[model samples]
Target: MTQKIEFIDLKAQYRALKDAIDARIHKVLNHGQYIMGPEVRELEERLEDYTGAKHCITVASGTEALLISLMALGIGPGDEVITTPFTFVATAEVIVLLGAVPVFVDIEPDTCNIDASKIEAAITPKTKAIMPVSLYGQPADMDEINAIAERYGLPVIEDAAQSFGATYKGKKSCNLSTIGCTSFFPSKPLGCYGDGGAIFTTDDVLAKACREIRVHGQKRRYYHTRIGVGGRMDTLQCAIVLAKLERFDWEIEQRMKLGARYNQLLDKHGYQRVKQRNDRTSVFAQYTVFVENRDAIAKQLNEQGIPTAVHYPVPLNRQPAYKDICHGTVTAVAERVAKQVMSLPMGPDLAESDQQRIVAALSEAVKIGGF
Candidate 1:
């Protein structure tokens, strides 16, 4: 009936930080150091302190961050990495790209994150590590996952692309595991202007390896120490993130408040909102909820001018790209969640009035979809 509201409201964010953002871009332009520039180091330092992690290495993109982390771990042909199939393909794609096997596990139906209990059963002599995606901005049960990894002496990498500002039991998302990888693809909780990403870690050797891998495995300039990739984050993108950091705290706070408000609104209306454990706080990167007749509901919401999307309508194991790679069985919970999960408008700049509008429209849509 009316024009759809912006899903992420990036314009609102830009309007709020126009001057600062422009100034940051202009500074980058003035310096003309686009690759591995001063701002890159500055942002890395800020992010390290923010995450309370010992090291942070900015990379070309979130996917690149994952690749670099895997490469640094010495994952190679024939190795198997345990991960979920309900996440963004990059979680499993990177492992497969390295010639390593992506051992698909199922996710927790409520959280749509890797089920820690399912991981141990999937491991084998070929299992090298565990990579868990922080789906919809909530960390997986890291304490349990870490415990399992410690017992097996395996490394864990948190795919925190959606959960950068999220917290788990008081620890930051990217700092909760052996290595954490995140993306800044503009729509993320903490995004940059263009594609950029980073890897977080406390291990000195892993950190060093990641740094080397990010820059073509060079020990010094042009001196190749090992096989690697050209994965350095651009300076301009770093500057944008640096500028956004000025308001990042406020943005994250708004996200948490909005998430709680969404939960309250949905539960008040009798919607089956996804449960968030008390020990973990989701940044609500997607503000997703489950309902009957998801497709019909999404269509009705679209007709009412509220833009909505599915985080993933299909699990990775079911995808064409992954089916041939893994001949193993898929998790039932992940498949069920995939059919029901729908992401509503989410971002720091999403207005309360807009949220109310969304909730009202959605309530109507759900009733229509149920029919």
Candidate 2:
């Protein structure tokens, strides 16, 4: 019997970086300033420099990053935010949580990202922001989206949870729009041991607002300036990220090379996969491909000791919570793609042998399942 392939191989990564990770964690344990230790500021400064963003505010989680950004922008009741319907719920959840409305937009059929061309028509008087999610670590068309937002006097937020190490038109993903947010969840391209996230922006005012908002909206030690939440990224998690950053560049390079290899194999096997644009690089948070009878294919692959997953099976607009909110909204592309998409094992540490096996299993599964 062959060994089972792991999806999002964090253990392999940990084994490789044990020395650095252990040292970093030990330092944090010794300091005892777990709340907001020196490592916190150190990691923030490093990320700010990495992305060329003037400010990088580490937050509790990816969801909090989006929520805080919306709060800082003064998005409240009756305001509308135009965003893609095919994304993790957090993108729209943050908008709706603040008493605002999330206007659903269809995605590009090939890339599965927000359709920038259709965005302009969605603008209305109540439109407060445009949030585009970089699905599967590939960025949406940021330049066109930004231009549209500028024309309409609206801010654009790049939900870059999966695209942290990715680049778009020579710039980093988390620094591409008016405000950018990313996650450090264990499966992300650049992840910490546990939940962590960051927000990036060049605007000083927005930066200050985000910092205050993360700390109960306090400008000083206990003087609350605005309503806020307890959303600070713990120092230990920051320290873990700092250690991971040591080899992040190499990891990113591996991801790109492996992603290209997967694409080649899939294409050779006559499988359809997500298309990455020439102007950008995806970290390949999940190397997903399209198939008919996705559930049957996944079941066959699992039986063959190949782990398969779905980035999402349901578009947010079609969910019970959002269906009524986006009533009568048509997102044909997103709905169709959701049913066909299936993710394969993907990570910086995935071996070429494992990738070949995954592709081979997928091919067999497709044949066996008669799809």
Candidate 3:
């Protein structure tokens, strides 16, 4: 008989939180304040305190959160936002949507984050901000990125879509930058039932700007204060997150412990893992690894009932949609990683036995492929 393994076991998590989640949903149903409801404010406060950010503005989605942050910073036409090509398209998409150019920077081969060393060289008079993605739940070198941004007087936006619960140098990922945006797209570290996201910031002015932007730029009823978007988080989603928070700490702990265990097992078995910087803690959003015959290995794992995924099969620079939008040439590291990276089953609810099974399958796959 074959044992079933999931790429991400969300059902297991739901089972664990059924009662709390049901109660929260019932509360939302009773209130009937779905849009920008009281639960929205409550979730925002909780997230703000969790991230140590001065303010948190919940939004419709992570994409909207990023767009609103860009709008808040006035990063519009003729401006340039420096970023990495290894990230999801949204990082660059929001830039283009605001009529700003995305200056693609190279990434560090190990961390797969925007190379802070290469950032200074990319700076130009048009550079408005440095947007570094915390790819795969590990934060980029914000200290170095922030230093470069400060030198050029540019704001830093951390696209922390995969790293909401991550930490760097004893500080949270979202709190490290001028502005941070995260998603609650169910697969994320702190996901809700449906689409949701939030913006974190220490700057009071930017916080206020983001709040206004999230509500169609409304400062008051029927009064447009500034250019904004319809990006409010739903009350039901907020309620779900509020309930998830009850066990979030424990869930983060489980992810960290399991991620470390995967690292150990893979290393002992001669599999290469995605490198996490020593200065930070990753929540193992995907538990990715690099393999010699990545596609063949993934297929073999699937044959054994061990599910796997690729965070990205292609680099943004090589994608059809991004082929012509380049402000610079593609980096060699990002290009190489796109073909080699594979994500194994990972989630807080993933059992130790299931993880061992995944490792064993991968080990066998490696031998089968002559790796």
lDDT of 3 by residue, 111-215 (tens): 888899999999999999999999999999999999988988999999999998999999998999899999999989999988999999989999999998888
Q: Which pairs of residues clash in candidate 3, taking residues 3 or more apart in a chain or in different chains?
A: none
RMSD of 3: 0.9
Candidate RMSDs in Å, in order, are 1.1, 0.9, 0.9
Pairs in clash, predicted candidate 1? none
lDDT digits (tens) for residues 25-117 of candidate 2: 999999899987999899999999999999999999999999999999999999999999889999989988999999988999889999999
Scored by lDDT, the top model is 2
Cα lDDT tens digits, model 1, 1-371, are 48678889898999999999999999989989999889999999999999999999999999999999999999999999999888888888999899998988888877788888888899899999999889888899999999999999999999999999889999999999999999999999988988999999999999999999898999999999999999999999999999999999999999999999999999887787667889988888898988778879988988888888888888888998888887345679888888888889998988899999999999888777872
Give the local distance difference test score of model 1. Answer: 0.90
Clashes per prediction? Answer: 0, 0, 0
C-alpha displacement of 194 in model 1, angstroms?
Answer: 1.3
**Candidate 1 backbone overlaps, count:** 0
Candidate 3 worst ten-residue window by lDDT:
321-330
Evaluate model 3: give its lDDT: 0.90
